[model samples]
Target: MSSSNKQAGSLNEKAGISSPEITNASAISQIKNKRRQQPSAEELISGIISGNRTTLSRAITLIESTNQDHTEKANQVIKGCLSEANKSIRIGITGVPGVGKSTFIEAFGKHLTSLGKKVAVLAVDPSSSLSHGSILGDKTRMEELVKDENAFIRPSASGETLGGVARKTRESIILCEAAGFDVIIIETVGVGQSETAVHSMVDFFLLLKISGAGDELQGIKRGIMEMADAIVINKADGDNIKKANLAKIEFNRALHLFPSKKSTWQPKVTTCSAITKDGISDIWETISQYFELTHETGYFDEKRKEQNQFWMIETINEHLKSDFFNNPKILSQLDETKKAVQNNEISPFAAAQILLDKYKKI
Candidate 1:
């Protein structure tokens, strides 16, 4: 028997089902039978709603898979869970490397858990195959919160994608929500414009900053400040308290120079010391106030709906690109087209059109 057929037979036997006859016809029949036995959308939805973490993780893995065969199943699972999703608060936290973002999140998440809120943290680290980066360090930094039963911490690395926003983070958000998490915190490696991707996906964007450095604001860019719903000046205890306060005032003035974000809301600037755990309550209050104002004005729901639509469109575009490049015919011709352009026999634009057209025909 072929290895593939033997594997299939073993799977069927392990499941206490009768093995099919070992033949090509039986092999095709067994494959169809196995596919039919795969969990349906309803089963996945039920598992998620029941707070089965394993099922939740599997669903997210399916969505994150690059395999074209999984796309349809992933979509069905997401659609099934859509009605049960979106009830959780999505907050994005970002800052420069030394801004102590993970420390603040650990402190902040602990405080929320104290208030009886279930928190899930999705921290996206920079991809480093050979090194243990800060995010792995976060597991150690957030030891208290990580040990809490009510809190979940998932650290993902930024792949080829520009933003540290892991390709799986979006789907993971759904899983977290279905598992009854009240607050979903997304932490990104505060690398300037790339962090904007997180801003687009969340309800509130919080920028963390530290004081006492002459280049304090030098690391912060105007574009990032514009995207901030609020800024938390960290390290506000001890001798740095005064410096932190000064930085707050500086940020407040800078924020005022820009027009108000919405008619009912004004961007806020606050200071806190994560190590000392001071001013954390005030930070939470500010976030609550923003949420209330936006929810009352219907902006919160509108924003979430828009974000979902944007993700759907973005995902489709990514899949289209993958499919085009992975086509054997187009890939086979890619080198020839590049050589033609190099030799000036054809323009780069024309070569691109030819490749695209060939894929379209396929």
Candidate 2:
């Protein structure tokens, strides 16, 4: 057979055309080395202070880690960044599903960046009960803002743990502030206990709503209404403008029914279209007014001090719960105890006592 025929017959023969490598071997090796080499706590702190987004994200990952070994290092980094933290305005935004929370955040975030503000968005995506994984698609949703040089968006998974995302979010805010982000926006999962958790951590909590969702007055029944620093009616454009205006009026009326807030600043109701960017600046103005009033009244600092105390207590409670569940003896007997309780062989309280006693013995 001819050489050409032999080449055609050989299925394993190399291609006739030699393809050039698309990637650099040396660069790939350097990236691998960088990934393998973990920066020390001090280095992470320094990087965060110097506004390195990569280091800030790495440090936040350490905080979110469930590995016991990472806890100490995470704490050290947080401690070093403490002073740099708390300088930024922490804003928490939440809403019901389909309320365009991501779109509104993108618009709001872009508006902030336009004013030369360094913005960091911590978006918490709900984790699946079965898979225990988060889609974490906030970056995809906020396409324009994600590309903005002055904006940083980090999406985190809201784990099964009660305080999982909340605790990590609080810590991540500190890192973002240390990274020189003047504005920090925390977008909650919009349901469950997430709103309350986020409310406790933020200086300003804005609830995003849409027109014609339901009876406008119905929202007043929710505890979230009480916690809101402002309620924004999103997607108010084209034909929806009139409905949005009506919703705003209804919400404003509803706001007046609630007793005066401790901060003495009434929660404002406004409308905006994330697509058109209409009324977006007005929302910022409202927030600025809130900060101005709160600062003058000393509520800004006072609320922060109180939140710090609350977190300290929450931390102790969380550690206690973790230690109790993670106890080896309890883990060994947990299934049996749970089975006994489920079968009515033992009372829940008594079974809990048994676990407590076992933990105590250890």
Candidate 3:
């Protein structure tokens, strides 16, 4: 074995964990000695742009990794695929639980695919310690749709965040676009107004509602409603058709009461039944119209640019926080600083500055 391989093996054994270096070296050696070929990042990017499922999955994994060293390579892959991205219509869907959000998506996604459009569904489930790393089982709710050749489904856990969305959902959207998906649907857990995280990244915000007697409005939070580009009254078929119509009118009135969006686009309210497949097409048409009007008025590009800026700022802040907290000296001093502040020996502000200064010197 090579020196690096031996060192990697020793580290893995000492740490009682599988070392990534060892795994990577083994992969490289296998490719060279057995497969006789290795795929480059450019090849992966090209394959992703061409809609290869395998490449798309790999690209998403790369972007979602928290490993520091993988970031540069991940960024390179994203940049190479960037020009081929941003073609998809990005949509954010949220609603209270039992409102049929998953069913609606499954139906809507199938509808889009039937129209010969490639669809990517990113379902953001609230993360729990027990289930954080596992793929959400909600895809089973989208069984038939999941089986569609042109549809891609990725269920991401929110990771101790209220939004039940991964921080990388925005980056995942870019990857999906590069993978040639025509429509990218982001589904958030229907837990009150906190779900608005999806709103910032999508072109249209869709709120799914179930018609309940006057209680519909009670379940709807003002913050969430204000961010909605469209309110969908789901489960509109069977015995609830009349009630659904009433609920739609009520929501429309409530929507009108709110000031118009900054983009000058009026939010629309409609009713649909995923079970009976009613009004799904009209919902799709409304989304298309919203995109058309927004694009024509230049808001589409402007909104995307703003989102890009927001992500840049957020990423920088995250990097600074991670770097500061991970520094060995800062970490070692954290307890002492906290105790000093508690004992009134140093003010919190001064303690913070001291730590920051220490970090700067390091």
Best by lDDT, which number?
Answer: 2
- Ten residues in sequence with the least summed lDDT for candidate 2: 3-12
Between candidates 1 and 3, the one scoring higher on TM-score is: 3
lDDT of 1 at 44: 80
TM-score of each: 0.83, 0.91, 0.84
Query: lDDT of candidate 3 vs native?
Result: 0.85
TM-score of candidate 2 on Cα atoms, chains taken together: 0.91
| Model 3, C-alpha of 232: deviation from truth (Å) | 0.3
**Taking the tens digit of each residue's C-alpha lDDT, what string does model 2 give over 112-217?**
9989999999999888889988899999999999999999999999888553354588899989998999999999888757888898889999999999887877
lDDT of 2: 0.88
Rate residue 336 of model 3 by lDDT: 90
- By lDDT, the candidates rank as 2, 3, 1
Candidate 3, run of 10 with poorest lDDT = 2-11
**Candidate 2: where are CA atoms >4 Å away?**
1-33, 163-166
**Which segments of candidate 1 are over 4 A away from where they belong?**
1-43, 129-137, 339-347
Q: Provide the overall lDDT of each model, using Cα atoms, as 2-decimal numbers.
A: 0.83, 0.88, 0.85
Error of 3 at 168 (Å): 1.0
